[model samples]
Target chain A: MKKLSILVGVVVIVFGIALAMSFKSELCPYVTVSYVVSKGEVRNVQVNGTIVPNSTKILPNNTLMFNLSDGRTEMRVIYHGILSHYQEGIPAVVVGSYYNGIFHAREVLLKCPSKYKVAEENYSTSKVLSKG
Target chain B: MDIGYAFLVCSMLGILASIASSIAYLRGNDTRKIVKRANFAILTFTLLSFFTLLYYFLVRDFSVRYVFLYSDTHLPLVYTISAVWAGREGSLLLWLLYLSIFIVLSTRRLDKVTAFANAIMCIVAAFFNFLLLTSSNPFVRLSFHPPEGYGLNPLLRTPEMAIHPPAIFLGYAGMTVPFAFAIAATYYREEWVKRARNYLLVAWAFLGFGILLGAWWAYKTLGWGGYWGWDPVENSSLLPWLTASALLHGVIVEERKRGMKLLNYALAVVTFDLVILATFITRSGIISSVHAFARNKEAYAYMVLIALSLLLGFVVYIKRKDFFKCYHSYRLRERLIQGSVLIFALSTVTVLVGTLTPLLMHASVTRSFYRHIEIPLGTALVVLLGVCVVAYRESILRKSVLYSLAAGTLAGIVCFALTKLSLASLGVGIFVFSLAGVIQGYSSRKIDLRRAGAIAAHLGLILLFIGVMGSWMYESSYTNINMGVGQSVHAGDYTLKLNGFREVNGNAKFDVVAYVSVYRDGKLVGVLHPKLIIYNLMRSDRIVASVDIISLPLEDIYIAMGGVTPQGVASFEFYVVPLVSFVWIGSILIIAGGILAALQRREEKTRKGVVDAEGEG
Candidate 1:
């Protein structure tokens, strides 16, 4: 039994370490507009920010060009695909690389926000149970 | 709204009362009557609360906060019914309804462990009721009623998304049966594995069906021209199904050799735990996913549920270590079964790690990362499953494996000749090998319900993987095809002619439909009407690409209208996705196989009972 447990433990540890290593290698750091500007250039990164109002334009070659800002810094973002779920003023997470003073987005994640939100309650279930 | 809230509290209190009564009954008291009454009360109150909420949705009552948020008067009656569980709070209530029903069914017959299992189940049901009562109440009414409700997200208005949540939550609730049984069994040892066996299969089938529906929905609506984007939320849902699949194999091995009992118990525990984990991963916004419900501290409540299950499992396993028997000197088939379990565990870990990297490392791994692990591991799993099934006949092991390898090589050669892709050919080879093994097993085994179900499921697995590989590796896509009226483009032996475009203004929505004609070798096949829909109510007037797919012999011709400019130039994308139909067909086969397998077990148990009674006489 001891031997079997040891064997299983060693296998789990080795596998976990291997997964961590690969995950680290494939990591796409979520950076901000300021971080991208300061770092000069970064590869395979994601930036979450709202689109600058009236900043989105169609380029000559049908590419989309917009300015993504993180409240303080704004970066020029270019995408080569159709933005089906994108909306003005809603935050989007853009995944790609930053180079040549332009953030080339490979994928952009956006959602059309609903007018009403799921209501939140501040009371606790445990407190109710205790009182009962 | 107040009545609904009252029913929720009543259900919670009833569940608590049942738990206490069950404990007293277990402690040598005649509290069975109280336990039975409490269980009835729970069912009544849970049902009343569910119908109360449903009534609110049916009437489009904007005074009820959840109904006001998710349902609109414009929604169809079916969608309004589905909208009851569209949010976090309402879905928890739905889950409790299912749990309470199952709890009433399982507590009908009181046995030695029945009280304990009943207590465990009541506790879980109570937790959900508590959630509905406090943090995420669906019945919290507004001071003044709004004139109309805010409509649901247009993306979720489709038929598949409407029913997907209920199916998924039902499966998750069904899983609690096995968990409570497995844990209760450890208290006083018996063949508790047998009791939970059918429940496990039913829940596993429901989950599989739900996942398949989600995939189909994604393909139809997501406009991505592909199903399964390797999203973290999708991976979380797949986790419990994997453990349940592994547990199915473990049960057969245990029944055959009376060994691997410990492994089966552990798998049950892990399966339930993963369900909880899936709930947390999907509902919580800690991980980036397309399907995140809401981000709040209340989502952490699911974590406490996970810890409770895990802690219960751990304490039970420690205390009942002697109950789980470990046998030595296993037969060859038993060893093969172990290989299946090991491979399943590996795949589960791979998915779990990939799903969690976003949280642990602050980085979500890409689809490429998943493909790297999944393809190789999936291949190994297929090969092992085939080998294990055929290994039931001891003498032909070497011959079958060798023959399967030969068939694989031949498939690889043919695939290479057709597609000229080595990796694609190699995958084809692996698929052929597994199919051969399943066929060989059928040839040897007698044609009973059990054997027939197993073969059908194995065949489904083979077909599904073939679809996955063919669609992933060999799909041909033509993008950025710009066209005006009467323009035509050739896409790999098929020509797409843009006849024209027309605009349709329906109630509250507008659509731009492109009339595209398809031809194969100068023969007009069919015309596809791909549209871009814009919901008028949306402030952005967002355009959602509605895809149209035409099924060919072994592939699909998928076309979508991208956008139309004012200059009359339109952009479109066409993809020839091969063997995509096999995915759905195979999934149906697998679900049918689960039901068939469970039915066979029930018949076998009855037959055994008759034989034992005859012997006793």
Candidate 2:
């Protein structure tokens, strides 16, 4: 009985893993924003860049169009989701593919700018205090 | 500042003291005084270094690179304090400081294994101090002070952020106790397992609470209405916590029946190694993770060190394999309990494989992969819990099994009829049956704290399973909306209205607050104020979703703002999440169970101490 149970457990584990593999969704491979723009026909690739803030426009079918730039190259991205809490100049990672000069993003991930890098020193302490 | 010089000097002294204590222990001399003095010096020096960093942040000293990187002059006093560990270097220091304190506290027992444990802990502390002194030093001065400092992350400004990292670090540092005991068990004795068990429970509680807090923070702040993304960084933490949980259960079996000694020792080594792996993965840029801290060269060194540590642990296990030779077949209860632990261990392996697969391959595994493995394994674990609790009498076990089968079939039928989701229905049926069996077993006992804690914690799993099933399988989300002011939109049975908007400026941030009203069947439910706060200095905006929740006993109406237009057109997402509160309530019970178990152990220790003292007298 003990041996049988152990065998049963092994079989179940293998079956579960196989099932998971069958149901597994392919992850988008990481690529640069410039690379995505250069290729212009890549499918399901992850691109990271800074969001060009004022470029965000709400489109007709729950879709959003924005420009993402990596300091050197910029690409227009079409995302079909709620706008995440990110603004212009914040770095973000979008997973999708480029087609017809536009990247249709399946997912958008934003990195906490303050958490990941030092915030810029443009605004002075007095300006912040004045706002308060 | 001379403070850096002083901190380095004192840390150097701590290293000397630690080495001396280890040498004294190896020479078969009385290590009590050396261990005590070494632990004190290490704790004091680590505390001094921590405070020095805190002092820099408090004084807005941009001269210190870490200070300049994490804080600004306009930062609040409370946030300035939290800024101490907001960066990579400072967070490592925080881990080191916690480890120093853990060393001092855990060594106070002065058992026969003290020398060995102290030696192992000191070696661990030395490694951390070495990291602080060289590669990732927080005390490095900038070449020139900038005009203004960068502020802490706006998302991390929450109250939970201040406590979450420290709690998680304490748990990570606390696991060194069991690691040391594992080594000690290999060399000197196995009696230290009792002390090790207490520390394990405490560490498990801390880690569990930290994970819970992180989930809560993510749900509240991410504006993404869901929690537990199973991202690589999150998976890293869960990996070690799972192994440690398995170790917790395995240790009890070892203490009671001496069968799983080898397994428990291996778990300790694996748990500690996994913690290091977690740290390395999170800090190192090996994996592209949004949640990971910025990558640095120190990550490579960490990788090498972790590799060597794992190799060393493997060698030790190989050498001590003879000490834990199992001789006999286990009974049904013991087998069931051990099987459950093995199942948890298997789950950890599955998660680890999935996490590492992304690093090796071009693609990452989706959440569906983990869910596929966890659901059936989780169900099996829940069943094992019931079996272990009732396996004392064969007749009773058989009768209970039959009853559970009948009840489970009935519940499964009802569940399928209601939801038409077969897997979820099966899970619900098994959960209900297990819960009933556990409650019955508890009621029959005298209800000691240990039994009560174990039962409560186990039963909490049923609720958690139900909660996950209900929320994940049955929840509905509506994403797209453009609602103008005073406009009502229908979502399920509820009508949500965009009432109005207002502006508030305070604490160096400007908020655009949107008033959202909910109505059900022409009756007003509640109004939620979701604010968009944009900091003046940082220029980063955060969505402070008011989370207008209509809380029911078994379900919730969770609503939050997506974005708002300047012209009063707002986008809002509405969710009908069922039994989500049970997840939070179940986590509380799990933590309480751990604490109660620890308290029971303490009481037993006191009783034993008194008995030994009286007999000696």
**Each prediction's DockQ against the real complex:** 0.21, 0.21
Could you give the DockQ of candidate 2? 0.21
Best by TM-score: 1
Worst 10 residues of 1 chain B by lDDT: B285-294
CA lDDT of each prediction against the hidden true structure: 0.78, 0.73
Task: List candidate 2 stretches off by more than 4 Å.
Answer: A1-9, A12-16, A19-26, A31-45, A48-58, A66-77, A84-92, A97-103, A110-132, B109-112, B143-147, B283-286, B289-295, B414-424, B539-548, B602-617
lDDT score for residue B340 of model 1: 75
Give the range of the ten consecutive residues with the poorest summed lDDT in model 2 chain B. B285-294
Q: Given candidate 2, what's the lDDT at residue A91?
A: 69
| Model 2 TM-score (2 dp) | 0.88
Question: Candidate 2 lDDT, tens digit per residue, B108-134?
Answer: 866557667777787777777788788
The worst-scoring run of ten residues by lDDT in candidate 1 chain A lies at A115-124
lDDT of 2: 0.73
TM-score of chain B of each: 0.94, 0.92
Off by over 4 Å in 1: A1-21, A85-88, A113-132, B284-286, B289-295, B538-543, B601-603, B606-617
- lDDT, candidate 1, residue B334? 75
Candidate 1 per-residue lDDT, tens place, B111-132, comes to: 7688999999998888788778
Backbone clashes, each candidate:
0, 1
